[model samples]
Target: MHASSRHGTVAAAAPARGGRGGRDRRPKRADAPDWAKPPARGKQRDFKNEQRAAGGAEKTRQDTPRATTSRSERGVRASEVLRAVAPRTSAKAFEDVSRGTTVLFDDPREVTLEEQLHYEREGHVCIRRAVEGVEMIPMVKAVTGEIIARRLEAYRHRVSVLCPDARTTELKDVEECKRALKKHSQEDVGFLQTFNLHRNESSPAREYIMSKQFAKIAAELMGCERARIYQSCVFVKEPGMAETNWHSDLNMVPLDTNDFVTLWIPLRSLDEDDAALHFANRSHRDFALPYWRTIEGMSDLEGRYEIDTYDELDLGDLTAHHGWALHWSPPQPKDSVPRYALSVCYFADGARRLETEELRRTPHAEDEWSYETWLRDLQPGAVAKHFELPIVWP
Candidate 1:
């Protein structure tokens, strides 16, 4: 229930309620008083009030807006993309992601040496149309059903002074939620985030997050023989959500490894105004203990680094960045759709826990949570090989 930009409806506006159609079909002339006349040109009409004065109540469609998306339709959509959890027709596609040891590169998604080198030097790279149409359908359905459908009650757990709407009464849909939201807040008002979704029981996300194509790319980019997924997170920014502060993935992770990379997959296409993820080129080289931390405060550093972004990402397109690469997203434009994305963090299969002292050296807000969630089972010097952090590649 994090702040999430989502799909449509809720306003009494015509478009949302199927304008005109939601009203009585009887002739309007009959409802109008014989003495009443249309408002003069260049002015407006208060038809409802006039009707009331005329002793005619405008009849509206009785069904509430929430029922617009019929239960039958919702049922159909949920089942449609689930016929095959993994889109691949190959028998090899059926393994559980957690222990799926072999990365099947034979499916033709391997990265070229040149592409791998680009990542090595720039700390980030975009793979155009890395996923296909069928591949994205399930990804979207899984996220929308899990996040957006939960609505506003879940997003306001942390109130933001900037987003008064975050405290509004529970809303019916994405559009209504967006309208209620006042503005973006650096505190992440409109952005809904959930981590380890792949691990959720009866999850609809494992197929995409654990896709071997993604793992093979991670392995190639990290120059490792195998890769393990540390976590899979879904981030959705509702329209009107604010800019994210500059930060690095590794800065919040408790693992000790420079071999990490995160694959950011957009469920739909994106434009810059859609809250595109931006990165500081070559910034991974500057990352270490407290590298960007202890600064006066979080601020944009385009002047200090060569900031770059894809500006647009088609539905199948996704980007991967080094764990330590600095990145951020802009405030999403109000009228735009929610920006939905899935991010899977991977590392060499043998990644170990950060030294106890080093872990203590940095007071990352997530350290305690991370330890409680994934690292409590292993000692500091031990290779991270718990049930949750599975080896996703051979």
Candidate 2:
């Protein structure tokens, strides 16, 4: 077994009994604690009386009225028991017990305050069945096909023979674009990233992005008065794609606040072996950390944080992480199916653009799109409220 250590490294755990080393031999009673000792193999232990005894005197009193008591009588009995116990028990203990047993069976999708606190502290939270009953497989296939078609069209102009409807316009530029695409295609193109799908108002992806269910959760997780969808993209990672290097989204974007968040929704079920996303716990608080410029830079900061990841996640399960949270994914397995995921980035309302020379100088694709084009007109310290970044929540 592998366990994550405090410093984000994988720790080896002792193998289970009867595992590869044949370590199932029973321990001597002298060395084992009374609670740890198992009963004789062929003998049966009588646990009925013990169970009844362990339930205490209160259990007997509670059971006496179950069959004959009216609903009001049962409530009175419960009240009486509470009164009797109230004097002896600490208020905190009683409160804890009450909280432990208080269940609202009707609202199954509720997120408790404790969970919100965890998200605040860890900078990320995974919510199971966040968007149920939505068939993601078909959506994934459609988006994948669209991206491929778009890429082919962009590259076709470069190859004269490949262009079906060749016109006399801009042949030189077309050839240049095709050559660039051909070179990229020859390499291990890790994933097909189709960004700004929401810009196309008629796209199905746009409708999904604007759904109230998704926007509400994003707003809640962000603890923002409102949230706006700044960017949306579909990532299709084919088999044998290279691992995504560790990095923080905030460093790559021009946003001034750490209130920015990203929602990662996988199109299918994924296990740990499927290159599921991994995060460095509470690393979002490390604001002094410089922008990750190289793989070596990421490695240097590994020891400062503990890594967190899900062992398995079903479809409809999604994860939301702070923009500054350090995260990465392993390389796609050679034999596994392509991994398709939709990523939507949300920024808190009133977020401003940062004036960082480093961000301006960075040659990353995200910087170019998010800063150069999206926030081109807005000066540093200006509000990030461009038409391209629309508010999705209130």
Report lDDT per candidate.
0.57, 0.54
- What is the C-alpha lDDT profile of model 2 across 1-394, one tens digit per residue? 4454322333232110000110122122122222222223223222234446777654453233211111112121112211122121211111111011111122235555754776788787777666442444445555555666555442332232223234424444545654554544333334556677667776655656655566667778888877888787777666666556556677656667778888898766664456567776777886555434423234334345556665455666678888888777656666566677788888888888665432322323323444444554565567776667777775
Clash statistics: count for each candidate: 3, 0
Error of 1 at 148 (Å): 2.7
Best by lDDT: 1
Reference-based TM-score, model 1: 0.65
RMSD of 1: 18.5
TM-score of each: 0.65, 0.62
Off by over 4 Å in 1: 1-98, 101-106, 149-190, 287-293, 296-300, 360-371
lDDT for position 327 in model 1 = 74
What's the distance in Å from true for residue 149, model 2? 3.8
